[model samples]
Target: MSIDFGLIFARMPEILAAFWVTVWIWIVSNVLAVFLGFGVATLRRYGPLWLDLLLRLLVEIIRGTPFLVQLFLLYFGGPFIGLSLDPIPAGLLGMTVYSTAYYSEIFRAGYNAIPVGHIEAAECVGLTRGQIIRRILVPEMTMLVLPQCVNMAILMMKETAILSIITVPELTLVVGAIGSQQYAFVEAMLLLALFYWFLVELSGFLGRIAEARLSKFRFAHS
Candidate 1:
């Protein structure tokens, strides 16, 4: 069958609009996830044992389930529990919760990788726990785990397509609608792939820049 490049070009506006939605959701979700994950990791490390166990259990539950199922439960099953949410909110909530679990683990690993002597030295120097975390631990841990975090961000970007299943009007959903309406399945699919490819490539490029800058900062501080 012949491909129709014109059809893809014609739908560029809609595709780009949807692409922006995906980007917005991904950014918001991952930002919240990272901060919340860091808090979770910190608590697990230094908080009381019961709280750590509870957070650990929750993390494992989220990580163990499929994201799609999580989304469905939030958007569809939520009404039964008086917790209804609109599509975008549900998608955002689901994505944040799902990513927080993995991000917590990544930060947890970063915490473990820090030398104990560093903390001891900070203690000897009279830096409060909060001061040490802000002045030293956060920066060091960020440098150590940044590459992994970038990988996770890229994976999360791709997973935004799954939100389309919940009718979130993201890139994949818009493209699928176009395909269905115009019987241009191949063109639609190709365009969808192209949009995602661009997003993933752009994310990788930015991630590399971030890693390089963070590396320089880490060394300068060292």
Candidate 2:
């Protein structure tokens, strides 16, 4: 069968609009995930035992389940619990919860990697716990975990496609609708792949640049 590249060209506007929607969700979710994950990691390290156990259980539950199931529960099952949410909100909530679980572990590993002596030294300097975390631990941990965070960020971006199943109007959903209406599944699938490829590549490129600059900053400071 012959391919019609013109269909892709004609759908460029819709594709671009959906692409931005995906990116926007990704940005908002991951930003919240990063900070919330760090907080979860920190609490697990230093908070009360009950709180730690509760968070640990939560993290494991989130990590253990499939994201699609989680999204479905949030979007479809929420109404049963008197907590209904619209598609975009449900999608964002699901993405944030899912990403936060993994990001918490990534940050937990970063916390472990820091030398105990560094914390001891900060203590000797009369730095408060919050001060040390903000001024020292956060900066060091960010540098150490930048690569892992980038990988997670890309993973989250791809997972945004799953939100299309909940009818979020993201790139994948729009493309799928086009494919269904036009009977051009092959062309639609190819175009969808191309858009995702560009997004992933762009994320990786930006991640590498950030890593390089951070590496230089660490080296110079050392």
**Model 1 misplacement above 4 A:** 219-222
Give a tens-digit lDDT track for model 1, residues 100-186: 999999999999988888889999999999999998799889899999999999999999999999999998999889887778888
Count the clashes in each prediction: 0, 0
Model 2 C-alpha lDDT versus the unseen true structure: 0.92
Q: Over the stretch 79-170, how does candidate 2's per-residue lDDT look in tens digits?
A: 99998899999999999999999999999999998888888999999999999999888888889999999999999999999999999999
Ten residues in sequence with the least summed lDDT for candidate 2: 213-222
lDDT of 2 at 47: 99
- Cα miss at 125, model 1 (Å)? 1.3
- Residue 137 in candidate 2, Cα distance off native in Å: 0.7
lDDT of each: 0.92, 0.92
TM-score of each: 0.95, 0.96
